[model samples]
Target chain A: MPRPAVEFWFEFASTYSYLSVMRIERVAEAAGVEVAWKPFLLGPVFLALGWNDSPFNIYPPKGRYMWRDLERLAMKEGLPFHRPSRFPRNGLLAARVALVGVEAGWVAPFARAVMTANFAEDREIGEAAVIEDILRALGLPADEVMARAQADANKLALRCQTERAAELGLFGAPSFRVGEELFWGNDRLEDALAWACAGAA
Target chain B: MPRPAVEFWFEFASTYSYLSVMRIERVAEAAGVEVAWKPFLLGPVFLALGWNDSPFNIYPPKGRYMWRDLERLAMKEGLPFHRPSRFPRNGLLAARVALVGVEAGWVAPFARAVMTANFAEDREIGEAAVIEDILRALGLPADEVMARAQADANKLALRCQTERAAELGLFGAPSFRVGEELFWGNDRLEDALAWACAGAA
Candidate 1:
């Protein structure tokens, strides 16, 4: 039987998604599960719920604890983590670029590289230069990818993806979808993989 | 110099708190840090934010992932876990009773016992009989505790604590405060302890 696949629905600006992006492939492979990278924007989703910004920033104590917790978790996982000065960075371009990559079958690698740049290296992902450099390093045509990312069709597709996520009852980033079952957060990666494996069985 | 203490601010109904409550003592002891249990209710905090129920329930994907993640984490930590049927159960009584125990200096054990009953035994904590049994098992006056829990002053105190939590900018349950440094969630327990111990130096 062909292995059932889990769709890893992620946003470029999500911190936990960075961790999952870096590790999900290896983790899923070890567990004998297939992963499909689904890049989408969380901005519209948050706005739909009347949130003007990330909930972590709106709630200070939770935000404070999240940073400290991330530090500990990063250390435990041996992943680099530094709080980016510009949080809730505009992820529209990144999402559009990811959409293009998905068409080109480079979605996973592009997502991982972007996540590493945003979370591990603490780079300003909103800067087109940085993203272009990431694309160039990946041997993709930077100008072509950027042009596609700015195209009206790509933008519309990104919006449609966001709407789809909301329709699926996803209010947060770093969510996973296996058939109709939706799992949220990097912590749920294991369960999502397990569910996908079970479906294969 | 007196060793600085880390305040473990927890909600009695928080599942993550159950894991921390069971293991914090040993972890803190090994790190040579004093842990002060600060029992508080998350209900008022939620209400103040215009939320009618647990964010988990309001956001189904996040809620579903949280339960599954909790199970995986419990297994990793070698702890027992069973999802309670009545989630977000009326924790008012539990919190009030915990406040009473804190005043009487039995907060730690009482907190552990109650958590065990809720998560380990999967008991309906909203039930008066179950709470009474827990209180009796702890060698406390069940009737007296229940009565005190309902008193106007205790109710006011609970409100005050929730207000203080908001004033402190807390967003969720299972937060920790080490001196002036606040760390939120079970994930930050180690950092909280380390910060507390460092302050002692």
Candidate 2:
């Protein structure tokens, strides 16, 4: 029998997504649930909803509150946090690279490293060189991974995944899907896990 | 010394505020904290942010997810759940009445009753008759309370409180203020309580 599982859909550029990506693996493992790390872009989804920029950027007060909320949450989780100089940095390259890692079963660590670079260390993960640095640091073959990441198939895979997110009616990132149930935001992580567990019963 | 207290800023029409309003007293009491009920309007706040409609209604996917999320949260919180036929019912009259309740030491129960009317019972609380029914159900003189609620002073006081919310950077309902620290959403109720307690310590 398959272990209780949830599909975690996240975008690297999302601040709330940073919270979930950092803790999901540990939380899921401890709860005896399997997590399917689904890296997708929120840009297209936002575009379809008629938002050209991050909603946090489009709405200033919400944006201001988000950073402070992230700070408090990071402290609670015992994670280091440094505000990024940029808001909603490009995640195309990192996401494409994550698609490659997914196939190799290293997506979790690769994604975490990219999130740390973007949110914690304020590194630009959009550049190929920075991604290469992350891969090499993770003891993976940076050159080969970069080659696969830029290839036609990986790019389209990300597009399809994003379309899937829109179809799932997702308006934001760090969303979790347990069966057909959708849970949004970092706070709902525990609830999603609980739902997955309850469904298995 | 005064008990460690949190000023709960809420809008009567907000769904999440219903969740907080229903359980805040119990939760705050258990934490040994005091709750300062501040009934305010979100209409002005939303307008200041250039959102004429509820963000949930403006963004369909978000609106859809919100109802489902509210249902899940209500179930988790052991509160009754029902979907309101109308979204974003006007809370001006309700807010004014709550201002009256605030002075009479009945704001907590009054706010909870209004929230239950809007969310759990699907009643149109925007109507003066419905609000009067609720006030009378609590054994208060409905005619006197309603008359005071419509008075110029009480109406203006509610307006001032709403302006206060905007000045505090409150873009949403069910926001908790501990000193200058602001915690938004029902999920942050505990965090706000903790912040209050921590500040007192």
Candidate 3:
């Protein structure tokens, strides 16, 4: 029988997504659960909900609590966290590159590197140069991959993937889907894996 | 030195707040942390957020997930849960009565009973009769307490408490504050107690 599996739906601009991407691999491997890395845009999702920007920005208190919560959570995980000057920095370019990386079997490493660069080093992952640097560091052909990522077909594929996410009733990042069971937020990672494992039975 | 303490800020109509209310006292007791129950209304908070109704009502997907999450969580705790017909029943009267309970040293029981009635019994907690029933169950004078709860001073006091919650940057229910460190959501109860204990040092 095939191993139990979960689709990890994440957005590059999501703070909780950064937390999940950094640690999901080890946990998934330990649980014998296959990880399907799904990089999608939250922009369209928010727009559908009548939010022109991240809810964190639209609601200042939630935004403030989120940054502090992220910092505390990162510290507990021993992961370096630096608040970016820009909130919800365009993850468009990074998501595109991550799609390329997902197909190249370097999704985990590439996603983690991008998150670290953006969240820890205060670097912008939205820039094509930053994404190119991430791809090159992974020993992939940056020029070829970048060209393929920006191709009309690949762009359309990402759009369809995001639409699928919306159809799945996803309204936030770092969501996990185990079969038909959906677990939202970074805090639900464990619960999602447990659901997947239970389903395997 | 006195034991470390944390204030548990909750709303009667909040689904997650029900979960936290049911479990927090035992957890706090086990951790040797003192808990200060602070019941406040989320109506004002949401209004200040420019939302006329609960975000769950505005966002169907989120609302759907919250109910499912609450049911699952409630079952895990061996607690009964029935979905109330109303999304967010009027918590105004309950909050006012809770303030009265706070001074009478019956805050925890009063809050838990109201949550159970709303989430587990499908009762309308907004009704004065329901609040009176809960108060009488606690052996408090239902008529007198209900009358005192509606006094102009008590009404204004509840308003002040909600305003204080807003000033503290609260955006959601079931929040915990250990001095200035705020932990939001039911999942953070354990962490909040830990933070309180650490602060005692």
DockQ of each: 0.43, 0.90, 0.86
Per-residue lDDT of candidate 3, residues A1-201 (tens digit): 668999999999999999999999999999989999999999999999999999999989999999999999999999999999898899887888889788888889999999999899999888999888888888989999899899998899899999999999999999999988889999999999889998998
- lDDT tens readout by residue for model 2, B46-85: 9999989998999899999999999888888899989999
| Model 3 regions more than 4 Å off | none
Task: Write candidate 1's Cα lDDT for A1-201 as tens digits.
Answer: 888789888898887777788888899889988877778888888887777899888866566766766776777789888778788777778888999998899888888888888887888888899899999999999999999999998899988988998888788878888888777777678878888888888
Candidates sorted by DockQ, descending order?
A: 2, 3, 1
TM-score of each: 0.77, 0.98, 0.98
lDDT of 2 by residue, A9-113 (tens): 999999989989999999999988899989999999999989999988998899889999999999999888999999899999999998888889999999899
Could you tell me which 10 consecutive residues in candidate 3 chain A have the lowest summed lDDT?
A: A92-101
**Candidate 2 C-alpha error for residue A112, in Å:** 1.0
Measured by TM-score, the strongest candidate is 2
Q: State the C-alpha RMSD over the true interface residues for candidate 3, after superposing those residues.
A: 0.5
Candidate 3 lDDT at B128 equals: 92
